[model samples]
Target chain A: MSATQSRPEPKQDEVYSALASARRPKPPGRLSMCLTFGWRGMLKIKHVPEQLIDVTLTPVLFLLMFTYLFGGALAGSTSEYLQYLLPGMLVQSVLFTSVYSGVALNADSTKGVIDRFRSMPVWRPAPLAGAVLGDSVRYLVAAVVVVVLGLIMGFDPGSVTGVVAAIALIVVFSFALSWIFTTVGLLLRAPQAVMNAGFMGLFPLIFLSNIFVDPATLPGWLEAFVHVNPVSHLTTATRGLMGDGASAWEIGRVLLEAAALAAIFAPLTVRLYRKAS
Target chain B: MSAQLAIEAVGLVKTFGATRAVDGVDLAVPRGAVYGVLGPNGAGKTTTIRMLATLLRPDAGSAKVLGRDVVAQADEVRSLVSLTGQLASVDEDLTGRENLVLLARLLGFTRADAKARADELLEAFGLADAAGRQVKNFSGGMRRRLDIAASIVVTPELMFLDEPTTGLDPRSRNQVWDIVRALVAQGTTVLLCTQYLDEADQLAERIAVIDRGRVIAEGTPAQLKASVGQGALHVRLLDADRRDEAEQLLARALDAQVHLEPDPARLTVPVTDAGRATGAIAELSAAGIELADFALGQPSLDEVFLALTGHPAEETVDEEEAA
Candidate 1:
């Protein structure tokens, strides 16, 4: 007890030595910071493995349920439905899972991690960019699941080139779509709000388009809206690439929509994220 | 550039919607001195610290940290200064070790150097055992220690600690105080914000008493206590009805401001000399006021706050700040 009575006096001479050991040699470049933030985003998913359930289980279940449940009703056979619905499912799965990027960012912002990153001397946009980069894995996971499940269910792309190009296009589109979610996450105050907003905004885009059915079957006015829908264009582009019916014009249109989305949301997300506490 | 001052500001202001959280504040903190900003929760101490740390831009005025403007040269200021916000800002998903290493790496350390620095900090902070545990699992005190350690991944010349020991037990509080002492011993300029008067008294070489977003008083603790005069005299009346009579007697005899309402039937007045106590007692007896208790004591920080602001520190916190 006597030994604990007296507090230790702090020594003064070693301060410089201690600081030298902890010195920052140089500030990381913007690209390195982006990668670092991306790595952090992935680490969060690793720690909370439940976060990946959306990207993993949802894709498999959707492929099985939609291919079997709607195949006969719409396309006249399960095999025929697989060809039409698999491409749609791929787009839907990636689009849905990409929204989690916003939810996760919202959750992270509520905590102190974002503040720590902002306080650093590194590039300011690195954390936001890294988050999108890290969550891109979810998009990758969704894309793989849909393709593998579709191929196993007796679906054919008609050409390996078409399958590769379509998968590549889907991945790019998901990455672009994630920027929109990132913007929503930045604007919202709570993760639950981001999740709700994401689902509400994405549902209309996915269901109202030709992702699940032909637009011609709708009323004339409804058909017009569906044809102009961005998601509808993306689904059409995917169907063409995977079935040999895709026109260069259709794929080009999808790319332009992705570019437009990135152009608008990327700057907004970065601006909002910089202003985040 | 004034190399002797760690911080210099002129009329810094920040408003939240209709509430002027911080308004027209000025500060000059000399290098190598521990300056404390003492206030109640919503007194705008945290907002002022955030502005100086470059976390929030001020609505008016300007501030410089380590000679760099907080807004225009925020990047340079960030490199030279660090902040441990009122909220511990460490990553919860990462392990204590991983959190430190990640910040070290982000600060431009090589992988091996980052690991080495993380290990050293974990060992120094007595977090070696919990190094492998996720930060989310750490106790409040452990998390606070890690949060502060992360800020020093580079030994910043100036550090801002906003309520560093707010929720800690006495033992943990002492540990944080020791850390602050060590940092100052090594020439780091510290600006600590706290509601705990004793904490500021113990660690700060100078203090500013802030209320309603303005610095109402600024001085060393001894000077602030001295400004209230020699000491305070407490006189309790046996009959509640005679409280006013006793208060009048004391105020007339001592020729000083008298304070009432702190107790149901008590009279508190400032006295410039211990000799005034005798005069006060005689005056009360001459006025036929019986006393239940009588004591004379030196001023505490609480009394200092009361004398300066007409309200105690704990009760003066703005409602918005409390939320």
Candidate 2:
């Protein structure tokens, strides 16, 4: 039997008649196009639920593994260490999840969809900007999972405002960090390269920082290096805000770092995105 | 600067490192006409289309779509034109209807308007039933139809279809051809780039035979065929033994190179006109060589390309691929 034999043939007149009656209005403005692409990013996640695993499972596994596995050794008990480790894990998980934005963007560029988007008369940077913005949801998810799970694990943030401020900091930082990956995605030829490059570069920054252990306990030279690590600064700021009240100076420095990254890599990603074929 | 011209390009050039993907090429396509760029694979058809569609910046020269410079006023040109690439460029992760709706909304339709426009296009392209199915699950032909539909969400003044039917079967190819005809009938100017000569002959009002990143021959299909030599005359000898004699006799009689075929003992000679076919037939019969078949045939596109480029399109594709 013929494949899909029951499929009916569309009548020629019906097709022509429908096309003739189509009324095309003026194209949407820049913001509308940006929002449309942002929605597409979420739609893609909905279609492929596996993409949610990083934000969902990573928080659970990393929080549980690090808390129970190294909690008693690092501190006196799992519950005591959970307070410090949870905030750091939030920063770590959010950082790890941010790379997927670049991987997704790179994957999208290789598909036929980017060619169609380029041909459209919409805003030139909408797809890139929307992708970066839409990926904020992942950071939000990771942040929420960490906070809710940390509370259940007996890790208290002490105040709602403090938790909100810490999550806000992580999201802003993740948004800026996504630009770095976005630029990489735009420049790289393969999606796999974006992931590999992201992990290889980010792992050193994450592991060598003050996330897992205190920088004060390390040797003088190593402590000095860890003190200067951007991840260390971010994790420290996050812990301060999430635990007690953070100093304005400490919060301002992380914000400055995030703003600097956005300032440099946002324009760079846009330029490279424009040049991508 | 003619008002009737939809697209005008002068000395357009694009180079990729060491390779000049799109060499100095010029084209003048009149409004409401199908202009076909016929070439083999890697002959720069896609590259030229990309430049005209404002997807790639030309290294030299300039092009104007609807009087808007492709470089200086690319946004204006983009607003007035749409392009369906060789690959079906619709998003694969989204459903067919979702893809159309997304493009429609981006093209500025309101939520209701976008949904209505999408429904119309889905039904129009015979994709209404498959609207809910993800594009990755659809067949190639369906995806191609959806891609074309996506491009026309705004009903652009000028449209570029780059090899719209490259890998389609005959029926699906016909469907695409019908769509092109329907678009042209609706007052849209179409610039179609394809390797299939028959596709150009059947659809394009004018054909440009491009090879090695340059237009070697430009004319109507019939005009290009006539440029090679007029028509061809094929004669089949009844006796296999007299194949050589028949070839020699016809070559001398017609003053043309006669190609011999042993399968049917056939000899084909290029003739200037239908009048020359009579002379070849008379001479073949006079030599006591009974003819099984004799007919005057118009030159096919393969012959036209062979005559103009010194190699047929199929052979050129193979040679370039091998290289």
Candidate 3:
């Protein structure tokens, strides 16, 4: 290196030759592309492990506070409330965690990496699908925290298989719900805006549903709203799976709602994403 | 016809809420050479590039990138072109190596091949040492080098370098120039958008000077410079107080308007005859004004813009607010 320059000369000739000799490989299948983006999301978590703090802390605090503070007053005993409140807590925790899907998308868009991904020849929905897939892992983490804490606090389920089924149902529902937030993310310009809107919309659905108390305990008008709330259906379905058993019709309705959300918002998110810039 | 040209955009228009950022801009960039799109800030350079790259849909008109319609065959166009944006497009949270690997994997490389290519690019760009470090912590130069490396992980027929060296130091800028030259040498057509005149003069064989969403002038660097004047006479004064006196004296002696530079001690006069310039220097000497430096050189791209647009190249216009 000369005194005029501090850095080494870039190996330009070698770079050109490498580019010249290399062949463009076959583009990956859609699934692989989505998974690669999922891997990217996981890498972000690895670099900043604090991304999981909300997933862990939210459930712990919500579960403990709801079960102890209001449990005796509502259900006659903390242990009785734990059995009912734990299933609803799983729904609330996973849905709350789903808000990050939109926040992360907004962050990516603002950072300009979304341009890089969009300009590439990969599947159009791969990035969005992969991000939600990555977030499913967080949903699983939240479920695990809630379930494990419930058991230690004296909540019991009918069977281990039932608990597994219940966790799987909630995770799938959260995955579907994440697309709605991703659409919100694409519509808003800032991550903070997306987070705010996501939670503001969710607070009513989470608190006004059967998560912490029975919908029957409410007035007729409020109960009607809770009965129709998708979060309430998801919570009830989760409770049935983890407790005695839920009806096929009840489980089917939740799956239909999840599917409908994915069907509507996935395409909506992709459209907004394509038109974003 | 499109085979010989890497990009052909005609009357492309893009408006953002009443602001026509790119208005009827047309471009024909030939293959295997650096085609410079030179403009100042908010001159619709980025917007025009975005429309051509298929990142933003044009409000009207059409574009063909590498002989394929950009809108109709966007996937094919994406397959054949890559854009290194003005902003660092790589993931800041990921390590330099991880960003490259991620792009490579997205480009269809196998797991092993992606790592190998990432390593090769990091080494070639002189970023081997910082490969493991997060990109957010890298210097502007390092981030720029990594961004370019990310673009070339799998080479395309054409590359869009948007202000690639905008804020880099001279050494890093030179390194980027070298990398760009290498890419062109290997048959990669580069559409380089830059505000720096010399960067265009050094790298581009043909230059398009766009101002306010239109191509005001298009020619080779020499032709564009010649359009303004044959040459410029630059004079630096020993005493800053005598600049106005020198400006008037030179304007009278040389029979041309003197352009005052931002430096109070310096002024430039566009000159066509060397004999008249010498007479102006003598006129300055007769006035007892000492000279620090004087040189007659080809009109730079800045002067060309000043001549064509009635304003200097550094003068930003209303388009910036929309941008």
Candidate 4:
């Protein structure tokens, strides 16, 4: 619009092209712009597996290393530690993996790929949407792979419905979270900045909660914050279903918290998403 | 499809802080003509195109494209035009066919329509055999052809090509020339921005030569050449400094109104007569002046550019973009 003419005399399309005028595409007929973008992501993944490696290996290693060394000090036994650590690892893996959305997006924007897309008549949200969907697969895959490996390593799953339901919730949260990080990526040009900011956030959130330790061990105020913490809800629900002696109300509470966060985070993230591009 | 005004840019000024990139240039490009904007780097050719492409904001200006106000009617303007930039802007990961089809689908074509259009473009651009090859591996020419092909899939009546053949080989450049000719044959209007004078000569119907952010000279290619000087001449100097001295002697020895480019190593003069160059060489040598290389031909856009801009097109767009 900086150059779209504002003259009183209206010009038709052909006249505009001759004059070397620039016009954007509107409601173009292609239904697969998002898929095309997704395909591009898949193509990029072929050239580099490092992106998925962090998602794939980071959670498994974090759980194994944290549980083996600190399990005694935190939970008094390795087995009890495994039960507590696995569920929170699920949420953490998804949240952490989503930060790549910001990194990859920033790289693409700086390279002028975003500018190229903006000039096209493709769907406005296709690039962001496709990338989110494509990358969410890694989060889902990582969570599942880590859990299956954890089970083989002697972590127990008590109820089939509970395990599947827990996994499904984490997937949705990760996708929602991707919307958030992607917005940040669009706003920032540097990927390293996004990674550092995401990591600095991750350390405290994981450290302050009952991800490994019993919540009863925390001080009163800190414990109160943990009681309502989103990670706590998911951990309690997963622990309860794993036969750690939680009540049905614990399951209800987790579902309610997850629903509330989804409701709160989704719309805010979407408005940010629109503005980022 | 026949709009009264194809483009209207009034008081279009785009500045970046202390630098006024496009310092209030006005332009009107009507339907079905190739309007070429020629300039050296930092002269705001690309910046002006960016404003027209709606990729940047104007500090103070208003434009309308195909009857839509740039800011107020951006989406409407977006619906009708296409731009092919200096570098090939196609996705490198996709195959030529996939790139075209994906763009077609995004542009609202049905699956069948998209495939059909993609196939047509592939054949048209001589990429049918390479349609399945990933674009990242493509030659410069192939990628440029694909870029233009992807943009024109919708048969946009308005196209903005900013230095479309900047780094292409001669064969690839000619391929684009054919494509531009084909588009014009179909009544599509093109606004071409290029540093290549010969390209403007071959493709543009009217030329707008910009220098230091203003239209210093404009007209048909022939008219611009006439504005600077008429025919061409060569000066032979035996030594380098004498080359400089010979330039001064020739400026006065032939036509008194002639202007000599500062560097006589590659000098151009207006007078066409062959004997005047020979006579000047004899007089300069007798007067103890020496020379190196000299030749005579028709007046070139290079001379016209130097004469009008007071500087050679020393600034390349690529180096400016790096900044």
Q: In candidate 4, which residue ranges exceed 4 Å CA deviation?
A: A1-50, A218-277, B211-213, B230-236, B240-249, B256-291, B296-306, B309-323
The best candidate in terms of TM-score: 3
lDDT of 4 by residue, B252-281 (tens): 878635445555455556775667777876
Q: Flag regions of model 3 displaced more than 4 Å.
A: A1-9, B230-249, B260-267, B272-279, B292-302, B314-323
Reference-based TM-score of each model: 0.88, 0.91, 0.94, 0.82
TM-score of 4: 0.82
Selected candidate, larger lDDT, 2 vs 4 = 2
Best by lDDT: 3
Q: Cα lDDT for residue A178, model 4?
A: 64
lDDT of 4 by residue, A93-182 (tens): 877887887787777766644656767655567787788777867777788877897798788877777777777766766676665566
For each prediction in turn, the share of the native Cα contacts (below 8 Å between chains A and B) that it retains comes to: 0.43, 0.51, 0.63, 0.21
Decreasing TM-score order of the candidates: 3, 2, 1, 4
Encode model 2's per-residue lDDT on B209-228: one tens digit a residue.
Answer: 88778888898877876788
Deviation of model 4 at A94, angstroms: 1.0
* Model 2 lDDT on a 0 to 1 scale: 0.85
- Return whichever of 3 and 4 wins on DockQ: 3
B112-223: candidate 1 lDDT, tens digit per residue? 9989888877767667778888888877677887887888888889989989987776766777787788788778899999887678889999999888899999999778
The structural similarity of chain B in model 3 to the true chain B, as TM-score, is 0.89
Docking class of 3: medium
- lDDT against the true structure, each candidate: 0.83, 0.85, 0.89, 0.71
